[model samples]
Target: MMRPHRGLDPGSVWAQRLRQLEQRLRTKEERIVVLETENALLHLKLAEYQGLAGRSTNEVLQLYAAHGQQMKLQRSSAVTQLHGAIKRLKQDLKSLRSFALELSKDFQRQSKTCLYQVLAAVQGIQLQNEAMQMFQIKAFDLEQCLQEVTERYEKEKQKRKALHNNLIELRGNIRVHCRIRPLLPFDDSAGHSVSQDRRRNFSEKVAYAADDETVLVKCSRPGHASVNKTFQFERVYNDLESQDAVFADVAPLLTSLLDGYNVCIMAYGQTGSGKTYTMLGPQFDGNLAFSIEEESELGIIPRATQEVFRLISEKPPGSYWVEVSVVEVYNNEIFDLLAKDSYGKVFGIKRDVVTTREGKSDVPLLTHETVENASEFLHLVNKGLQLRVTHPTLVHAHSSRSHLVVTLTITTVVFGDNFGTSWEDEQTSQRLNKEASCTFPQKMRDSKSTSSSRASSPVQLEATEKMKQVKTRLQLVDLAGSECVGMSGVTGAALRETSFINRSLSALADVLGAIAEQRSHVPYRNSKLTHLLQDSVGGDAKLLVMLCISPGQKYLTESLQSLGFGTRARQVQRGQVKKKTFPVPSKGK
Candidate 1:
């Protein structure tokens, strides 16, 4: 009733408008509540995502820290090991450097001694003053005097004679020979440029020659053939047949030495020749391919063993034995190739002890032992090869940096007094009728005979006593290749090595020259190599020299020099005496 009368009441109309405003306000409140609820839900979801993201970030940081720690630990450990290895390597280098220095000093000393000795040979130079006599007249007189001295020296020495006499199969002795061949084209070929293509072609030719030689060696039997008897048989070598032949001819003698005689076989050559191939061979391609363990590839040492066994097989057991000693001369120093001491250092051979009259004690003093077969000898030979030092050069692919010496010692013993005497053991007692009454030193030493009858049995007793201690030594030497300084392209250490090599070779040449001219004072102690080879050259051991030559034209000069050395070597004369003792075997006894 009041609303119907609102036209008259202003307060009633205002109240109605207020009620309409209240209804609209209620709608807006509802909208605001909905929006607040949605905002609260969104805030809760954001809080949950933030918590997960914070956890993930913490985990990643922890992982990075662990990884960094691990990397740091690894780096520390690697540094430790590297330091240790470097320290060890540095020590080894230091030792090697010291050794090199010592060798250099020794070489210089030897050179000085050689120079003095050579100068001593011409003593008359000091006698004539430069102003007193004509230089030409003095020279002529000196030359004439030298010639007279030479003639007298040649005529005076009947005691020392080179025993090249090969033992006949029945005599049980050894023979030594030298075989020289024509030069090769690549022997002296050197330089880095491709212009040295000729070397390649020659190498191919050598390879072809090696193949052919292999065929020849393969055709022969192990013990019966010469090829199998001498070479290393490891590799088929090109143009080494002459060496093989030399070995074959010496097999019987080597057997005798093993049976109780001393023998020495050496291969001498300039770089690029077949010395290595002749001695070492390629790798079991020749006679080595054919046989069993006992008779496998008759290399020089193996063949010698077989021959020794053959001789021993015919002899009474326990009557004969053999041993070997191996050594190397590196830059004039002696290194025991067969020594088991890994910590040992190589030492120089003293010049005083290594003289011609007094051999080197450091050259490996061999002890006597018993060897049963060829396999044992091969084992020792292989050991020596392992101990030898080899390097590569422009002249030689596998150049021997040292002088390798393999000495075999043979000892014979008669344990029982009841040994049967036959024609083989009987002494030929031919007496000198002219000197029948003279008492020789041998006769004086024999107590079995009376002083009155001592002269009658002198020859037989001396021969018998000589036969009692039938000991022999065999030497197999592989000398480092001699190379020219210019051709070798040497520098620094290499240069020093070349100089040493040249000086040593020159000393050797001087010694040979003295021997060829029959000089009274032969400078055998001038170089370590000569001193070490005293027994082989001037002592009891038989000497066999193989002068290897390169067929290449480039090597003509070296080849000629090698041949000249061979000629001089052949002219050298030596004495015959029984070996003092048996060489110790490289293998552990």
Candidate 2:
């Protein structure tokens, strides 16, 4: 497996190696000749070095002798200088010893002062440490208390959810929040354009907020017995309370609509008692325009719309949809203010309301305008408000002849999912008013059955029920102010309008009385107003009756009546509050 290269043979390799050796021998001989020449040069240099070395030794001896003499002279001079320096150093040492002794005495005195100060500082630091320890102990206790509170809150989370953001009045009861409207100058038979002094003299305030939950009505005449009645409500706002303060209590209910509860907030008051001002803002004048400054004066409606949309904005995209229906109960007949003509113009359409099988009142074929934001909702509301029936009466210059009911219908959907009815308590009283049942499914069945000419499979109906959208209603009712005919000085149609308003309000009162009495047959159909509000009052809906009161002696009688109505509403024990949820549909459909 091994092979020699082309020039390779043992003999040739040996001859090549010998030639290389001969070349190396010639190079060695040349090197030896160079070495011999170098040796001769080195011998000459060594002889020269010996002669130079001898001369250098002699010169070194001469230099050493000369240096020894100079050293002796320098040593003598250095010894003399050392003696002088030693004497001076001895004297300087003595002076330094005395100065150090003086410094030691001063240091001892200064150290005494410094030591006392240091001790005081140490004492102060010790006190501070003790205070710090006490503070730490207190902080620990507070932390423990906070932790306990958190635990308690976690334990009661369910019960608290019924409250829904500490709105305690929402607990299955009609919360009566009394608002004592301030005594404006226009509260007299004369126009409101008067001097400040005249306005003050005309105050004659009989009704006022006594406290946060009490309304005081004190009326004293020289010839009559004094009357002072104190009534308790959920919240009582003074005449001085701002619109924001009044709505703060109401704002909580708006969000509950999204949580699956039908919420109704009604303003109950007499004519010219600031009911409209409390429900809406101040009346629009010529331009129907207001500034951002007036935004503070906006009442529950605009603000509530804003808050609802704001809450909706926080939800998932397209999770919730809002539709608005503006209805006015005029002349005991309901008119849809938001109704649109075929020409795309809005006008009042006389609409009829019927009770749902679930005992909830709903208008059939009513116009519900879907709104995107607060501005659109308010635009629609403004358009509807323009169609409201108003007449210049002796009592109110701009008296609303009809009850304006603005309902915001909130519809939300979840595909292929079930809405839980866990909030429906098992021990809930059977005697309770018609609860807002799991009715979206009922609605689906009603729809499926009504559309049923042909037979469909169970799976199809189930899909329909699942795909059904659940909606809740937020009913904001601004009732027509109750007024006396003789005092109002009305004639002709004014009298007729007054008669209808009084009758509808009386019918509302009668319904409340029936509910309070727990009568078997509630006369909800007696009046359009009553029939329309049947579900809100009788059903498990959040009903907040904001009783607006005039703070002047002029309106004392009407205020008392309104206050009594609110009291009766509060007394209506219709059982616990429940959500109008979409329960699982029955299979019978």
Candidate 3:
């Protein structure tokens, strides 16, 4: 620390300091010159700034004064414009308030109108609902009235049917309806072969249907005088009459059959007449059975069969059953056409006629096929017809050699109390009463003490109301046409057949004649045909005989004979046709 002054002296330090001062003085002077120069430049810059400030101050003052005056003017104008805008806004607000009030009144008026319309609609709906209710009540009343009217109509229809049945019954049960067949080609040829002068003079019209009930046949004998014979019958059909017209007259008989009456419809005529055609229409080539599609050509039997099933279908189900049996009387012997042998072949079988205690004839061991409808019934009938003995004759191409009889047995079972009390019940009651009234001796009573004790007990009575069975038979007979031996041109067996046919026809005529005379001993046993038709000819059975005659001069004799038979048959009257009702005895009776 003390050695710090050793290097330089104080004096030298002072001298150096003075020298540094002189140099500093000189540098100061030079710096002062520089400062002076800088000052001058500064002064020059300040003077220019002063000049620019003076000019900008003057411009700013002038701009400030002008802006002040403009602001004053704009303030005055803004005050006026604001006052007008406030006045327009107030007017717009007043008009909006008035419009809102008017809109509210209009809304209230519209709301009132909608309310009135809703009320009117509600009232109209209520009126419509009331009217609908009234209409428903009237509709119900009308429906009830219509039902009553329908019931009345049904009752009247039933009454009319009953009266019609009675009227049919009033007419003779054995009725003869005569039918005149049209002239065939053979008849025309035979007539043309005769002298033309005689043909024109002899009147081709040998037979004429005078009226509904009379037929006039003029006998044209070669040697004998011409005798005009008038025959009366229940109904007479001319050649122009259709099968429908013919069946219309016979339809009532079928109704009676459904009513439980035994009915028999027979066709009798000479060869080449229309017996087969009347009972069975023109033979179909391959179709042997009746068809519903062939309604126009349907014969009496087929129509009757359809009608029977139709009437039965109208009744309650399971209340009735129909059975059919077909048989032929050939060579004075009864043969079942539907009979089956042990080989299952339909062969000729002999059948014997048996009489019941009720005076009904039955062919025992005959095949009775139960049928349901018309088709099935006609099928069986056709099968039997196929089995019938038919041969070609000079007079007729397909002539039936045997008499065919189709029997329809209808058994109706009625249940419940509507059948009434049975006769067997009455008989049983009578027997019970008699047993109760019977008196026995004391010793005998002692011997029969057990029996007496059993009798003393309460006897169990049988059911009084029983099922009733009404059995009705509708017999449709197609008798072999009677043939003249000379005209038939037959020999050997054919001759024998003709003889049998004539004999049987004669026997039938005799029976009818006997009935007409009211003979006590009617020879019904003379022939099988008459015996089989005993009920139809004499008993209380409805019968219709269609006596077919050819309206040709060649068959004048046969036509007259057929007309005579019809007249005789129409005269033989039987009692009223009563329905055959029998009480089916209960089991173990």
Q: What is candidate 1's lDDT per residue for 282-313, written digit by digit as tens?
A: 44222333445423324465455566677767
Error of 3 at 526 (Å): 0.9
State how far residue 57 of model 3 sits from its true place (Å). 99
Question: Where in model 2 is the C-alpha error above 4 Å?
Answer: 1-171, 190-202, 284-290, 415-418, 421-468, 583-589
Best candidate according to lDDT: 2
Clashes of 1: 25
| Rank by TM-score (best first) | 2, 3, 1
lDDT of 2 at 323: 74
What is the lDDT for 47 in model 2?
Answer: 57
Q: Which scores higher on TM-score, 1 or 3?
A: 3
lDDT of 3: 0.71
TM-score of 1: 0.49
Q: Once superposed on the true structure, which residue ranges of model 1 sit more than 4 Å away at CA? A: 1-189, 194-244, 255-261, 284-298, 342-370, 414-468, 575-589
Taking all chains together, each candidate's TM-score versus the true structure is 0.49, 0.63, 0.61
Q: What TM-score does prediction 3 earn? A: 0.61
Q: Write the per-residue lDDT of candidate 3 for residues 1-589, one digit (tens) a residue.
A: 0111456543444445445545655654565466556556655665665575566555555655777766556555654664565566556556655655665566566556545655555565578679989999999999999999999998996797567556656755467788887666666444325676655543376888887678888775668898888887767888889889999888877887866678999999998789888998777322435355566777888888889999977765445567778889888888887777787776668887767787766667777766778887787788788888877766787878888898887765543344433422444334433433332223322321121112211112243233345567899999998978876777888888888888888899999898778788888778788877787777767888999988777667778788878878867756566666655443344
